[model samples]
Target: MNRFNIVYYTDPLCCWSWAFESTLRQLREYLKDDCEIRYCMGGMLASWNTYQDTLLMVTRPAQMGPVWMQVRQVTGAKLNERIWHFDPPASSYPACIAVKCMGRQSKNAEEEYLYRLRKAVMLEEKNIAKPEVLLQLAEALDKEAPGLFDLPLFKQQLTDETTINAFKADLNERKERNISRFPSLWISTQEDERKSLLITGNRPFEALQTLIHQF
Candidate 1:
């Protein structure tokens, strides 16, 4: 059987993607060694250049609180909306760059780091967009995962220009795919230019199973 390659386009700050975590984990476990999964960080909030007033950004929590409450009702995921009431992140680019830098350690490390970041934002309501918060996440993961991350090396990679560029490349790929939504999954073979399956928005495990079964 030929292995499938899956490109997951997501943003750390995206609640919809966070809600699909369970489904994604189940799909990965079911596929096991038969699939290759790559996570691409799509920049959710590039910047606030268009919005001049800081208050305009500050009021976002009000807008997001109700939305997250509805998401929790649907996905059954715990999300702390208080983070928005307090100090909200200005952009998701920093978190995206941090995840890209973590990839330098190992693929597993990158995935682990991304998972932690998402949990911090969605559950713990941590401001993962900050550099200090990101470094703290690295330390916590190092202690929790044990030998999964190299702190010194990870910090070094964080400052490397390539890491930032890699994140920008992901954003460009999102544009190329004409992806406007979070939690988009593109399944294809290495030998094929066409995608075998493309799923957009939050999806259930059954949707994934149905697509893979067709192959």
Candidate 2:
């Protein structure tokens, strides 16, 4: 079978990306052995310090309520809105870096870590910005995941020179592409990587399915 490669650009803390999880699962099942989904962590929120300057602290979480409501209506994915106030993340960078670190182990580990990170933020409402939380999540997952992710190495890599550089590189790629949205999909065949399709924002599963075929 011909291999289909897709670069999925998303953030772990993105509400819309959380909603798109079901669509991604469906795609995995649909594509089976024919596709490779490569994850590109788009650092959506660099820090709360950035948000504090523009929006002030109080109004930030308030703004997300309606947006998450819309996500619920469209994607039928549940979110704990209290997370915005209960234990909000300062930055999505930590989670993104963690995912990239897991990728060093294997794609399977990377994919599992991505989902676990997403769940921690969206459903469990944990503060994934904290290193302890990320490590805890990784520890819990290591028992069940196919390969044992080296905890000490993962911790070191989180802030290592190479890991930070990779994060910067991906962030730069997103900026160059001018992708201002989460849950974006860039689809192409291995034979012609340049000939691709870009799907931005949240769309229904049927829409994604159609694009998968069209691509």
For this target, which candidate reaches the highest lDDT against the unseen true structure?
1
Write the residue-wise lDDT of candidate 1 on 1-215 in tens digits.
45789999998988889899899999989988988998899897776543222422323445666667778898898888778778777888899999999887789999999999999998998998899999999999999888998899888889688998899899999999888778999898656637477889897899788878887
lDDT of each: 0.84, 0.81
Q: Candidate 2 on 49-94: residue-level lDDT in tens?
A: 5653233223365556566776788678998777776666778898
